[model samples]
Target: MSARIHKLIVGLTLALPLSCGGSDSDGGGKTAELTPGEKLCKSLQDYVTQCGAATPCDTALVQDCSSIVDLLSEPFMNGVSECINRGEGSMTACLTAGFGALTPTNAHTGLAASFCSECAFGAPGCEGAFFSEDNPDTAILGKAILPFSDSLVSEVSTDCATGLGCAGSFLSCTQGVIAQRAIPESTVQCLVDNLTGQAPPPPAGQETCVVEGSGGAGGMGGTGGNAGSGNASGTGGNSGSGNAGGTGGNAGASGGG
Candidate 1:
């Protein structure tokens, strides 16, 4: 939760399509060795079922649980996996309690807030110990984050404090976060340009909230696919998502794609 751990687990961070690639079988019917990303994806899916928070996003898209790959950070995943495996009941409950009914497309956003508590704030949580300083998710979220605004904090915190912001909707929480942006346009623009290996789209929010920049144009599709190709998934596709950035500020159930 380098970006906002407790707040994330405590209900501070996240938004994603969420998935890893389908398992590939070998020519002779032997299963090929699983890549690190695929292994983690399997583990997370298992955990989701184990916790009763299983989602059908990938299945709905026919990606077959391949969308939420790689996650935003390995460190983040490691920390979360460790914490969830620690036998804490609250963590398990947090998975379901933080958000309401989930859908395949918006599960990532909801899970982000649910994981905030132990993942970022608790002793056994991943909060400070993990979290990459600069990953696609953080880059996109960082651009939208606004720690300096008291009013924004108060407003977001009101619901987030309940460990359930956005009216018990993770998608709504993501949009709320985006609306509070303070990061510079140039900085976010740089993220799209270099990270996606493409020219950045128009900067989101002028100098305030962003559109996340790369969209489907890069990251998951273009250069970042180096490993993004059905792997652990960038920010789940492996980046914070130029697509989410595009909808981050919009008011609807569809923001934070």
Candidate 2:
């Protein structure tokens, strides 16, 4: 909601370069040794270098990049991975395919591949960064989905201070798109496999819930049936006594025994 956050989102969400037609032209061709994801990652790193050098240490751009890195790293990886697994060429490829699936001829759809690829893999410490930790699976799988900054914008609108909620929404949306556009049922299975390794403690309500009894002592007593016309003698006599206290006093009894 703050102006700073607004500026950050706007900067990150700016229109990105795109390349459609599935050709690896524009110097982004896949190397003989590299997977689609690796190629896309390299392109993203190149974009970041170009962008940073173009601005020469712009604070707003730096801040925006840092915020994006913090908020969207995991989602970017998940979405890209899912896209790769779903048979898309790479993350950029997947974005292109997804946009194509919805609207094939739109110029923006073709351009989205470049835009999303750069955004997804742009951050310094992110998976596709030039100095990133070594992880081939991440690099390849990360190619399957688009960047999730749009989802994050909605989240920031609601809670800008902590941005935790926005982060969660962005991740969830990223994973959801991966499942929807790329892998059909892989997300659930992947999560199940992950949780199987680490046995999480059961949730609070799943363990126990207690209820206390608070009825008065006499509250459970049942009313006696109407007295019969004849004399009655029983072992369990009513406890009522006195004019007011007596229950079913001999109202119908005659002068006889």
Candidate 3:
């Protein structure tokens, strides 16, 4: 065959799918449009189905998914509302922070410790189930719970920074706010101490130094400093405390006018 004819045949073959509009096996391959809530619910349902198929029959997983969705409905709605209120940038930051906080690596150990103490007051068996090491149900429950927890946290982190109360799932919301602000470990402990009516001891060892500005004193050039730190003094403040420190003027010699 001539080279031009060969190329033309190849092009025709490639164009076949586009002309036919994909496959017919999956009902003509027409994509069905879903509303936002429907789409979200479908995704959740698909995840549960896949997990169930892969793992053992987990009654707890079903219950956990149901409970989490129910518990999180208000919070999720509130989060969406808050995100809309804050504009895209802040909303994106809040969502990113919230998701980051919920990752297995960053899930708050302190908040986990306090789960039973504070969260149990209203969440019924959540504290017990969440804290119990022996519970096989926890894994499924944890996974199911993560979505709502993360959503609540994201909403709270966004809203709270704007001086608004997050409308649902207080524990997750508060944890999220703390995480988003990148609150210091000492400050977390201090808050915990205050909750329990105990005095918080100062952070140990040499006080850490925090450089100021959007990216420290060097702008983007400086390494991102630790969240909260002290200078030469003992008064290290919380990271992202939003408190302005005293501005330092240029140093002068004794002989200078």
Candidate 4:
């Protein structure tokens, strides 16, 4: 099971470069001028934005949002590139296109939609998930996310309906449940502080998402046992002896005979 999981991780990492956008675009070449939202969407092109509907985004482009490591990979950046390319200078359109590109399978549409809705509009005091009150691009992004929010949350998880709030950090919180991993509170706070368009916070310990461990059913080998020391009496003894000895006399055997 461990080997299979490792293989899956490796396969995802290796296969991403081919199907996802490559690392070359991560550098600040042309993307320097884009807004944070635009940049994020651009970075995550292959993931499906829509699910549940027949005309949903492409399944192949959908990403496994379970691991932050995988989420931040080049494929995500390539998604940014694709988003930017698809946007043609409109940041909201780019993000919308980026989000719209993915089409999660029927089984995952509920999960995917829940995540999208939360990431988009669930954060508190942040005007929806991705935009702050001061963000100038809200007019464009805000409108786009509204209807998308409806579509995004068309399907919901049980816990999702209850926790309609962000865990302080929009991206971290959404990715946490998506990955089924838990994000440390400290980590969530730190990520929220350094996120795009936000001022940097004071130095802090690195935060992380704890991936769940896998367990296997196994049986332990049994060990051999040692003989206990005991005394053994002789059945035969000297005939007519004082102690009722039989034809053969013998002392009681000891030391685990």
Tens digit of per-residue lDDT, candidate 2, span 1-257? 99999999777666333334334473467646654344334433443343222222222223333232332334343444344343333222332333222211232233233323343433334433311126443332222222333453333223321333432243344445434433434432333222122223224442121111122122334334343344553233344443343454333333234
Q: Estimate each model's TM-score.
A: 0.22, 0.17, 0.19, 0.22
Winner on TM-score between 1 and 3 is: 1
The lDDT values for all models are 0.33, 0.34, 0.36, 0.35
Which runs of model 4 end up more than 4 angstroms from their true locations? 1-69, 72-79, 90-92, 110-257
By lDDT, who's the top model here?
3
Q: Can you write out model 3's per-residue Cα lDDT over 42-105, one digit (the tens) per residue?
A: 4334433432222221222233333323323333424433332333222212222233233331
Give the TM-score (vs. native) of candidate 1. 0.22
Poorest stretch of ten by lDDT in candidate 4:
51-60
Q: Write the per-residue lDDT of candidate 4 for residues 159-210, one digit (tens) a residue.
A: 4433545323434434344334353444333322222323242123211111
Better of 2 and 4 by TM-score: 4
In angstroms, how far off is 99's CA in candidate 3?
Answer: 21
lDDT of 1 by residue, 51-148 (tens): 43322321221132243222223333333334334432222232222122212123233333434552333335322222224455333332222211
Model 3 local distance difference test score: 0.36
Model 1 bad stretches (over 4 Å): 1-36, 54-65, 89-257
What is the Cα-based lDDT of residue 199 in candidate 4?
Answer: 24
Candidate order (lDDT): 3, 4, 2, 1
